[model samples]
Target: MHFTAEQRLDGGVLERTFTLGEIPGILWTPASTSAPVPLILLGHPPLGLRTMYPRLVDRARRAAADGFAAATIELPGSGDRPRWAAAEQARADLRRAVAAGGPVDDHVVDALVLPLVEKSVPEWQAALDALLSLPEIGGPVGYSGGVISIGIRLAVVEPRISAAVLFAGSLVPAVLFEEARRVTVPLHVLLQWDDEGNDRRAALDLFDAFGSEEKTLHATMGGHTGVPQFAGESAARFLARHLK
Candidate 1:
């Protein structure tokens, strides 16, 4: 990992930008700590990291206040990374389907999300490998954020992840249901009840599919981006219980 920039935010939260090979990423931690802190991998939509920086840093600052470090990596085909033709095509197809006012085909959903899940999960694991190597970051990692499928896959396959907070606002391919059943880590899922972009039943079904014996769903009335601040505080509390 090559750190390109570093700054200390208010409240002693240290933010650093870095690159792991081609993947650009950001890490945030308390500037002064006597011992290593647990890490939270902040997952986000395919939107560029720059676009998501404000909210990402907010979560990081909260994690820092709660005595944890937070880090996030750019996803494949996102940010300043090279464009992916196949993913682009899949997105085009999805847009057309949504605009046509028809239920998105399973194949289309598969095309759009599965490959992302396949490609991004390993990248996240790699980031975890690098982030945990830092003396200030320790084990029992928690994952929190969107692109719920990626969170699901990582929870199932990444043993280092002890807990997760998932946002149920994305299309999930049917194939991932089986994978979801394999996820045994504790989970806290946020659902926007009135989200136009999400399938409420499908999100509920996905939550039901998770194999974790401990999982909580916090459903609130709002659009996709309208998650309340209190809801975020609740998620932080959940992560603190498991990761701290």
Candidate 2:
């Protein structure tokens, strides 16, 4: 992995854009730190990072100000990468099924999500390894994102991630709940209670399935993109508690 660009921000934070093979990402680090700092992995929503630029910047800046390093990588088929046709087809099919009020088949759900999990987990793990290898980063990492399933997979398999702040925005593919049962890290989940596209029942079920004894569900009223400012503050505190 190599940093392609670097800029020095106010208060000595280092802003960098880098790539590890096919994966492209941006990183924020506090400047002039003598020791390695905590790191938080950020996951983007379906709209991609460009559409959510403010949110990503806010979270990354907050993490950096809180003495943590934060980074966000482009998920499969996002960024400038050519979109994966199979995943795109599956998503289109699922949308049509949803619009028609028809039941989506289990196999179809698996097809839409499993390959993403298969590809994303290792990429995140690789990114983590590369990020941690840098002199400015250290242990007790955290994961934060609206990509709920990718968060679940990493929480279950990545031993380096000590905690996660998850946004429960999507209807989880059923099979992922089983994987949720294996997630042992502390979690702070944010749920917008009135989100139109979310399955409240499924989000609750997924939360209940978490294996971590110290997990929280912070539900507030809003749409999918309307998470309250206080909810973010609460998640930041959770990250500090476990990651600091």
Report the lDDT tens digits of candidate 2 across residue range 1-244. Answer: 9899999877778889898897778999877677999999988775666776678878888898889999988778876767999989988988887788776766667777788888988999999999999988997899998678889988888899899999884556776878899898889999989987677887888889989999999999989888889999999999999887
Runs in model 1 with CA error above 4 Å? none
- Model 2 bad stretches (over 4 Å): 101-105
Tens digit of per-residue lDDT, candidate 1, span 197-233: 8889988989998999999999988999999999999
Return the top candidate by TM-score. 1
TM-score of each: 0.98, 0.94
Q: Which whole-number lDDT from 0 to 100 does residue 59 have in model 2?
A: 89
- State the lDDT at 2 in candidate 2: 86
Instruction: Provide the global lDDT of candidate 1 against the true structure.
Output: 0.92
Query: CA lDDT, every prediction?
Result: 0.92, 0.85
